[model samples]
Target chain A: MSLLRVDDLRVRFTTRRGPVQAVDGVGFTLERGEILGLVGESGSGKSQILFALMGLLPENATLDGTIEFTGSGPTMVFQDPMTALNPYLTIGLQIAEALPKGLDPATRRARIVELLTRLRIADPGARIDQYPHQLSGGMRQRIVIAMALAAAPDLILADEPTTALDVTVQADILDLFRAERRDHGRALLLVSHDLGVVAGLCDRVLVMYAGRIVEEAAVDDLFARPGHPYTRALLATVSSLAAGDSELATIPGAPPDLGLPIAGCAFAPRCAVRIERCIEARPAFRALGPGHRAACHLTKTPGTES
Target chain B: MTLLSLHDVSVRYRLAGGVLTAVDRVSLEIAAGETLAIVGESGCGKSSLGRAVVGLTPLAAGRMSWRGQDIATLDPAARRDLKRHIQIIFQDPLASLDPRMTVAEAVAEPLAVFEPKLSRAERSRRVAAMLDQVELPAAIADRLPHAISGGQCQRVAIARAMILGPELLVCDEAVSALDVSVQAQIVNLLQRLQRETGLSLLFISHGLSVVRHLSRRVAVLYLGRVVETGPVAEVFAAPAHPYTKALLSAVPIPDPIAERDRHRIILAGDPPSPAHPPSGCVFRTRCPDAIALCAEAEPTAMALPHGGRVSCHRYEPSGQAPAPGLFKEDPLGTN
Candidate 1:
């Protein structure tokens, strides 16, 4: 059985302007010990799905559909560690707060130190008493990861955990995630706007646009043979140091506003290979290959399969 | 001819606990119509260098000349005139813009201040033309910053900065906040503008990929010092300094095969506090190629064969090189 399965997940926010459909009919299933990447730009409803699963949405937000999990509740590693961590409390205390209840004070302290040490934090004994402000951005992020792992949860949700960190530090954090998955056999749902991060870590990938899942495929397959025009454009836009001096391909238009109702496909207006039917009817997700699906009208036609 | 030149420039800030050297002695020159990128991690003084160029931060030492004239000794009127030639665009577009002002008004403010002889109609026409250059629609000119999207707001910011017809534009993380597609558009627009107007750009960013795409020459900064400076292609292809190598290795390539197969140099521990930098060398604490000589004396900038300079004790002038197999074993492991 899948470790976690989300079906028809929808999130709506009631603002003064109107009801904004932040996430529209998103669905995916994560397997045991698999690292699934939820890739999207800002306002793609990628983070909202994680928020809905964790039951941490704001008061004005409403969620629908079903989320089924076979293991304990998933732990989250937030994007900004400075805001996620408590500035007033010491690092040890904040980590201890996430541990199981009914443990003795000494045992809890020992466990906190152990978690810090495992995360490659230098001199955990001395760092335990230090506040969040005393640590660097990378250290703070490691502490947040340590707290997320304190409960030994089967699943972890990392929402752009390394976005604010430097590339060297980001590499270290990615290594830690790889180690966690390899050693503990834990499942991870990584939500990020960077394709490099997703390509480096994820086993399977889901491309989200506006508020819907436009494409889903294995990591290699997604990059090698993308089935959707939006995914193709996104991949083409990724600037690489290894690439030659060719002009970067770009999507011409911006994402549709969430407050207004979307007609047809959300990405049709920006898609280079958009068709007539793409403007009149919403494309349904259809299987192109084994474990690969794309929601695009152009995918059905011959010679257009990317 | 060199448009702007800095000789041993240093910027210091008065802190509660003694003075902080935000930008250590750094010297470089930007030629006319050239793009020079300052690449480094946070707290590396790249931003301080950008600010120092625009006279936003006072230089504690060294000489800065613009078009053969000392900028530090410029009179108030001369400084005001200099503002017309040098402009900056910040990372956060919405935060940098005045929330109360309309897009058109913000774009026209530069012309209004610099060229008081122009009529209101002329100012409005120029603003409209600038907005069109940045590809922002004229209909949204009256809308406030809060109503526009981030990409559009950034376009508006670009229009405002370029409306002054500045010869030099200091872009500090200008495209970092936008999405990938939008980032490409802005980068393309900046490149096109530079070509058409013969503009010199002092591009500051941490992303090496973006830097490689836009800049001709690259300077790598560390702890407020220029550790390496060379042609972007040469520096990227074969970095001479250890920090530059580590930084380039750390960036995750989009190709999974390359990323999985590549050897990475993961430096241990965080950067030491700038308030209490290590003696002799600021980076000796985290440098994998450090030696006893590195702690005894700071390395001076040495010229390379490819017309670049690097500062490191590993490459000594007296033919004394560090042991070959010193760091064969990964200090952080997981190579």
Candidate 2:
């Protein structure tokens, strides 16, 4: 059975200008021990979907559809480690704040130690006394992960976990996540703008654009053959060291303004392979294969000469 | 001939505790119209090297010659004049640009710096043309930095830098802050601009991928020293340095399936403090290939049999044989 299911999730924010449809009819399910990558550009609404699922949406924002956290409540690890943890709070105290109900102080303290050790934080005894600022960026992020894991939740929703970290530090944090998911059988909903992170960590990828799921596929199939033009454009910009010889092709123009009602496809303006039907009407997502799907008029017929 | 050449250049900061050598005895050469990328994780002195080349920072040691003339000997006014031929683009556009100045005024400032006697109309025309070159709409001329999007602001920054048609452009993490999609656009723009203007670039970045895409040749720095330098294709295909191999192994590929199967060369610890780098080989502290000799003496860059250079005692012919962990099988065919 799927561990978490977000069905037809819709999130809209009311602003002075107008209502912005941030996540429009987004639906996906996460199975036990599976990692799904939510990939998109800034303001593409991937964050909003995660927020809506966590029931952390702002008062001005309205959400529709069901977010079923089947096994356990999924806790989130935020992007910026600097602001995520309280400066004054000790690492131990901060982690203990997430302990489940009915746990005594002794039990909670033990839980904190176990989590800190499990996350491979050096010197859990001395480290717990230190504050967030006392730790390195990578260590602080691991503390954030440990705090999230203290809940003993079935799943983790990490939003750009390694975006602010250095390359080597990023590699370490990713290794931690992979290790945790493998050992504990914890499912993950990894949201990030870096294609490399998604490519290395995720089992399935759901490409979001202008608040809708534009494409979804298994990682291997998507990388091997991308049916959607947007996905292809995104892959070209990865700056692969091995694939350094090929010239890059960038998707021109900025993403569409969600405040203004989007007519036709959201990626129509920037898509290089746009058809006449793209600008006139919205494209419904069609199942291309067992797990592959794309919301594009051109990609409707696989390998078709559009 | 090399357009810009540095001979054992070093920079140090006079801190309260002691002298901090930010850039240490770094020697490099940039040929005309070539993109030479200096890449490493933060604090490796890539930015300091860029600053030293452009004379933003004081050179503690060595000599920097630009087109056969020593830059350090130039007068303050002449140094300002030198900016016309070599301009710099900082990492953050929002921080670099003056919040008070409009987009036009910012781009025009460089023009005024280079040609103070030019008429206002001519200056505005030049600024407009530069903006056009970067593909920014003319309507943004009146907008302040905060009013425009991040991508547009970066374009304005690039336009401002290129208004004088500088021969050498030093970009320090220019597109690192932008979204992946936006990063590609700016990189493509820079490539086209370089092609048309034949501008040489000193691109400083921590991102290996960006360096691979934008650089004709690559230099890997560690602890304020160059560990490897060579053509991008040759070096990336078969990196001779252990540091370079570890760095290459860490780049996250876009496809998850391939990523699952690939072996990552995970370094055990954070890089040693640059303030007090390890004795002998700077990388010996964390290097898997470290031997007794590695900790006793520093390694110098030696030309590899394969096209490129590497700084490692193991790779040095005078040194001992290559250790088991010292060398990696080339993922990219050496041939």
Best by DockQ: 2
Candidate 1 per-residue lDDT over residues B162-211, each given as its tens digit: 99899999999999988888888888889989988999999999977888
| Off by more than 4 A, model 1 | A239-242, A300-306, B316-335
Cα lDDT tens digits for candidate 1, A1-306: 999999999999999999999999998999988999999899999999999989999999999999999997599999999999999999999999899999998998899999999999999999999999999999999999999999998999999999999988999999989999999988999999888888899999999999999999999989998899999888878833235344667888789999998889999888777888888899998787889999997676333554
Q: Which stretches of candidate 2 lie over 4 Å from their true place?
A: A101-110, A239-242, A301-306, B14-17, B306-308, B316-335
Error of 2 at A88 (Å): 2.1
Candidate 2: docking tier: medium
- Interface RMSD value for candidate 1, one decimal? 6.6
Which candidate number would show the highest TM-score if scored against the true structure? Answer: 1
The DockQ value obtained for model 1 is 0.51
True contacts kept of 2: 0.70
lDDT of 2 by residue, A9-30 (tens): 9999999988999998898899
lDDT winner: 1
TM-score of every prediction relative to native: 0.96, 0.92
